[model samples]
Target: MELQKTILKDCFILKPNVFKDERGLFYETYNQNVFEKTTGLKVDFVQDNQSVSSKGTLRGLHFQNGEMAQAKLVRVVRGSVMDVVIDIRKNSETFGKSFSIVLDDVEHLQLFVPRGFAHGFITLSQQSIFSYKCDNYYDKASESGIIYNDATLGLDWHLPEEEFIISEKDLELPTFEEAVS
Candidate 1:
């Protein structure tokens, strides 16, 4: 396994060793010992979540607050996306900064988003299957999100107006300032 460090503190892109032959291919997604050793991160994922979305579908700028905060290991299974993570940790030097990566089935790359960050992705392919492992159980009361298109953050989702798709619920999320407050 290869753990590629990202600019964001404590975030990483994990590349697995893939063995391919004339017949097919094989790779190990997660191995406790290997994961802990390579990334130096000791997280015990309690829940696995998967979602399917079409091109231009923008999902979040979401996170769990306080004790319910979750660290996530995210990957794409069937297509591609421009995945983004924003450091929202109050005391961190990189707070309000963001990192973006192109994760797809072909590359089989995974992103590790530590707790205290807002995680989101916009499907770049016709459709995509996004899956993630959360270190903590999800609690609805603790769920919170920042507006995905907040001008202050200046995120480039790389989609045109007609193609962009988002939910009303996500639209109601607070702006970055409101969220930080």
Candidate 2:
């Protein structure tokens, strides 16, 4: 696998070395030794989560606070999505900046989202299966988020506002200013 940096600080895109033949295709999704050697990051994933969403569905701009913050390695298992992240680390140079990438089964690309960022995705295909590995376990009390359509973020979700299918919980998320405060 090759690790490539994104515009966002400490974030990366992993391109796997795929082997193809008449039989089919294969690739190593994750190798702890190689990952640590390649990126110099020491992460012990404690939780694995997956979600299936239909086109127009939007989730996130979410994160955990303080000690419960999580670093994530995310990928698409089937279909496609526009995965996005915003730097929220108060001391980082990229704070308040956002980055986005298309994740799909065809490319088999994975994104490494460091702690101190808000993460989310919008499904672009008929149905998509998203998977992620989190370095820390989840804590309900520590969970928080910025609203997906917060004016300050100015995110281009690539779908019309009327097309979005959002949860009531996500609709009620705080704004970027409120989140950082």
Candidate 3:
């Protein structure tokens, strides 16, 4: 696996070596040894979650606060998506900065987002199946989110605002400034 670091410190893009033939392809999506070597952080994943969404559907800009914050390894198993992560750690130098990548079945790339970052994605194909492993289990009480279209952040989701479909809960999320205050 080849790990490329993102601008936001510990975040990374993991590209696995794929061996293929007419039969199909094979690759190790995650290996603990490689992960520890690459990031220097040992993670114990406790939960795996999957979601399916249609094109133009936006899922996040979500995070967990306090002790419930989760570190995630995300990938697309079917179709494609434009995955995004925003650095939300209050004391970090890159706070408020965002990183994005196109994850598709063909490339088979996985994104590693550490705790203290907010994550979200937009489906780009007819239907997308997204999966992720989290270092921490879900805690509804600690769940929090920022508006996907928070103007102050000026995230270029690679889609027009009107073209995107977001949940009412997401729409009601606070802006960055509001969140900070």
TM-score of each: 0.98, 0.98, 0.96
**1 or 3, which is superior by TM-score?**
1
lDDT of 1 by residue, 1-181 (tens): 9999999999999999999999988898888899999987789999999999999999998999999999999999989999999999989989999999999999999999999999999999999999999999999999999998899999988787578899998989999888878
Residue-level lDDT for 55 in candidate 1? 95
lDDT of 2 by residue, 10-99 (tens): 999999898999998998878999889888999999999999999999999899999999999999999999999999999999999999
Q: Give the Cα-based TM-score of candidate 1 against the true structure.
A: 0.98
Model 1: lDDT of residue 167: 93
lDDT of 3 by residue, 1-181 (tens): 7888899978999999899999999998788898788778799999999999988999989999999999999999999999999999889999989999999999999999999999999999989999999999999899888898888888778777777889999989888777756
For model 2 the local lDDT of residue 33 reads 91
Clashing pairs in model 1, backbone N/Cα/C closer than 3 A: none
Between candidates 1 and 3, the one scoring higher on lDDT is 1
- lDDT agreement of model 1 with the native: 0.93
Q: After superposition, how far is residue 55 of candidate 1 from its true place, in Å?
A: 1.3
Q: Candidate 1, which ten residues in sequence have the lowest lDDT sum?
A: 155-164
Ranking by TM-score: 2, 1, 3
lDDT score of residue 174 within candidate 3: 89
- The runs of at least 3 residues in candidate 3 whose Cα sits more than 4 Å from the true structure, single-residue gaps closed, are none
- In model 3, residue pairs whose N, Cα or C atoms come closer than 3 Å (at least 3 residues apart or on different chains), thus clashing, are none
